[model samples]
Target: MSARVSDATSRLKSRRDDRRRHRIVGGLVAALIVVVLAAGVYVVAFSPVLSTRQIQVSGLKVLAKNDVVATSGIVLGTPLARVDITAAADRLAAVPAVADVTVVRSWPNAVSIAIVERRARLAIATDNGYLLADATGVVFQTVSDRPGGLVLVDAPTNDQQLLVDVGTVYSALSPDTAARVDRVVASTRDAIELRLKDGDRVIWGSAEQSGLKSQVLDNLLAKSGTVFDVSAPGFPTYR
Candidate 1:
């Protein structure tokens, strides 16, 4: 009987020892996982291994790289993970000539910026100088002299809609048709006119049905008239 009791006691002690060993192993494993996570966080967030060491810029023609870098406000040696990319993008986008911009962190110590500059669609006379305008009728740059290869437009700077209307009319013209134009003049949306390089005048009524008007004008240009009127494409008249 004593032997049986001793055997039972030994079995219970062995089971307890096994359970203790499992708990100790589980605690060590949990501690190791915590230490690994902490090290990873420190390396990613605070360590200089992934800090900004260089800035790369592309798609620049007229804009200077230094100017763009200054505008970005990204300090060198900043943590790559903590770079304020949104703020940098916003600042660069506010520039009048920049149509679109992309800012991103290039892994392992670099920041990349891509810029899309606005293309000049027209030039308008401003009090300061000639203002280059894009297809959307937004004036971007002011130059001391007129820029070549752009159709000049005469309109009130305060009238945004009139500028947009003139832009619409110009945009509708085909490349061949647009090349013939020397300048555009508009007092209102309905009074837009195109002066051809050959000293001919076109009466463009408004921004409506500009595509049809362009087509009709192309067909009408073959005929002989100093003044071409295509305000109504269905019933065009020239005198």
Candidate 2:
């Protein structure tokens, strides 16, 4: 009986040792798994595997691609996650011709930059050259000669708002009437005039009611008149 009891006690001790060994082995495996997962996270976050490889630019007209890319300051091999899209876009927008810009990260290691340049609506005469103005009255490009198919703006001062008003009025005219416009003069905000290519003058007051004024002027042009006053389109007068 003593020997049998001794044998049973030995078996129980062996079983306890086996359980401890199993627990140690399981703990080691869990630690290894945690270490492997941490390594993976570090590799994904900081490794060059996700760095920028190329930059693509679109919607370019007057601005050169190289200039725009340089201005954007987006470097190759930069981590895709680290690129600041808003800051890049703001830098590109500083270009005088760029009206709107969007910067984004293209998946799989590339950056895409899209630009919308301002359209030249009218030309303002300057002492050095002609300044090309956009629909928003922003003077963007300057050229030595006036561009064709664009009306000239003659404002008393370099008033951007006045030029905006002129642009608004010109945009309201019909295509045919717009093509006939030779020059726009604005001595004051409320005293805007349009000189037609056919040696006719249109007294178009402020930018208000421009659409109605344009329609009235179109009808009045059918009559024989040198000066057409549509300042108050409700009561048009011509001579």
Candidate 3:
């Protein structure tokens, strides 16, 4: 009986020791996993390997690269994961010449900037200088001297609809016809006129039927007339 009791006690002690060993091993593995994760996080978030080292620009025409870089305010050596892409793009969009901009982090050491620049479509004379407008009638740049190849506009800059109408008419002109145009004048949305490089005038009437008006003017230009009226294109008259 004494031998049986001692054997039973020994078995119980062995089972307890086994459980303690398992607990210790499990804790050590958990600690090791935590350390590994912390090291990986540090490497990715603070390491120089993924930091910005170069800048790549695309879709640039009028804006200089240096000017764009300065406007972006994205610093070199910043960790890729830490860059505020939205803020950088907002700053770039503030530039008058930029119509649309996209900023992104090209992983493993580069920042990419893609921008769409506004094309000069019309020139509006301002008190300070000339305001360059795009095809959508949004003024983008102010220049001291008049830019060539753009028709000067004499209209109320504050009248958005009038400016839009004028732009519509100007955009409808063919390259050959556009060259013959000197300036556009509008008192209201319904009263838009085109003055040719010569002393002739064209009553454009409104922004409606611009394509038909342009076609009629092409045919009328050959006739002997000082004034062309394509306002009613179906029954056009020139005198």
- TM-score: which candidate is best? 1
RMSD to the true structure for each prediction, in A, is 2.2, 4.2, 4.3
Best by lDDT: 1
Query: Could you give candidate 3's per-residue lDDT for residues 45-102 as a string of tens digits?
Result: 7888788898899998888998898888888888888888899999999987899999
Misplaced by over 4 Å in model 3 are 1-41, 58-67
Model 2 agreement with the true structure over 1-239: per-residue lDDT tens digits: 99999999999999999999999999999999999999876655567888888999999989899999899999888888787888999999998899999999997699999999999988898887798988656778999999887779898436878878888898898989888889998888899999988899999999999988988988999998899999999999999
Arrange candidates by TM-score, highest first: which order? 1, 2, 3
State the number of backbone clashes in model 2: 0
Give the range where candidate 2 is weakest over 10 consecutive residues by summed lDDT. 39-48
* lDDT score at residue 192, model 2, on the 0-100 scale: 95
Question: What tens digits encode model 1's per-residue C-alpha lDDT throughout 1-239?
Answer: 99999999999999999999999999999999999999988877789999899999999987899999999999998889889999999999999889999999999899999999989989988777788888767777889888888888899988988888888898899999999999999988898899999999999899899999999999999999999999988999998
- Compute the lDDT of residue 190 as modeled in candidate 1: 91
Name the regions of candidate 2 deviating beyond 4 angstroms.
1-45
Error of 3 at 63 (Å): 3.7
Q: Rank the candidates by lDDT, best first.
A: 1, 3, 2
What would you estimate as the lDDT of candidate 1?
A: 0.91
State the local distance difference test value for candidate 2. Answer: 0.89
